[model samples]
Target: MFKGLAVLLVFQLTGEIIAFGSHLPIPGPVLGMILLIVCLRFRTSGRLVEDIERTSSGLLSNLGLFFVPAGVGIMAMVQTVQSEGIKIGFILIASTFLTLIVSVWIFIQTRKVVERHRETQ
Candidate 1:
């Protein structure tokens, strides 16, 4: 776990450096995640990567526990949230509905592609 954490931090730091150096629109953490994903998708497997996979799996399996602090933070923001809450609520609702519609459209398109492949086969 410690080793895995160190690697994760390295990725994040690297991403931060890339962000500052390149002045990218995206966040460091996002780039770090992309880096990690690409590393995982590498064709060659090694002992170190295997260990990383184990640790990452363990961490991901307990992701909900990590969100507890965030949940608590939102719970603690009761007073501040009372003001300007309507605008936030509207944005959240609109974005969620937009995402849902986009996801459904993507699903339908993927299904059509799959259906076409099936017919050709």
Candidate 2:
């Protein structure tokens, strides 16, 4: 688990360095996650993968704790939230719907690919 965490942190730090150096608009953690996905795609080490999975499962189980800071931030900006509540609500709804649509579309496409692969096999 420690090894997995170290790997995750190293990726995040590398991503932060790259993003800072390149002045990219994307968040370091997002880049780090993308990099991790790419590496995991081609990696052949089962032990490392198991470690990552174990660590990830533990983190995910405590995912709600991660939202506490964001909730606190929203409370801190209560006035701003009140003033722009409608716009914020609209954006959130719009984004949620958009995400749902995109996710469904991706799922359909993936299913088609899997079906085609099965037919070939």
Candidate 3:
């Protein structure tokens, strides 16, 4: 578990370095996740994968704990949130819808590709 966590942190740090050096707009963690996915896809280490999966499952089981900071942040910025509540709500709703639409579209496209691959096979 520690090893898997360390590996995750290393990837994130590597991504942060690359993003900072390249001045990319993307978040470091996002880049790190993409890099991790690519590495896992090409790598042939079942034990490493198993460790990562176990670690990921453990982390996910406690995922709700991650929201504590966000909740506290909102509470800290209560005045600002009240002042811009309408605008913030609008942006949040719009972004949520946009995300849902994009996710659905990606799912559809992936399904099509999978179906095509299956047909060819």
Report the C-alpha lDDT of model 1 over 77-121, residue by residue, as the tens digit: 977678868987999999999999999999999999999999999
Segments in model 3 whose C-alpha atoms lie over 4 Å from true places: none
Cα error, candidate 1, residue 37 (Å): 2.3
Writing each residue's lDDT as its tens digit, candidate 3 over 1-121 gives 9988988888999899989999999988889999999999998578888888888999999999999999999999999999999999999999999999999999999999999999999
Q: Rate the local accuracy (lDDT) of all candidates.
A: 0.87, 0.95, 0.94
Top candidate, metric lDDT: 2
TM-score for each model: 0.71, 0.84, 0.93
Instruction: Say which candidate scores most in TM-score.
Output: 3
Model 2 accuracy (lDDT, Cα):
0.95
lDDT: worst 10-residue window of model 1: 43-52
TM-score: model 2 vs. ground truth: 0.84
lDDT by residue for model 2 (30-120), tens: 8999999999999967899999989999999999999999999999999999999999999999999999999999999999999999999
A best-first ranking of the candidates according to their lDDT comes to: 2, 3, 1
TM-score of 1: 0.71
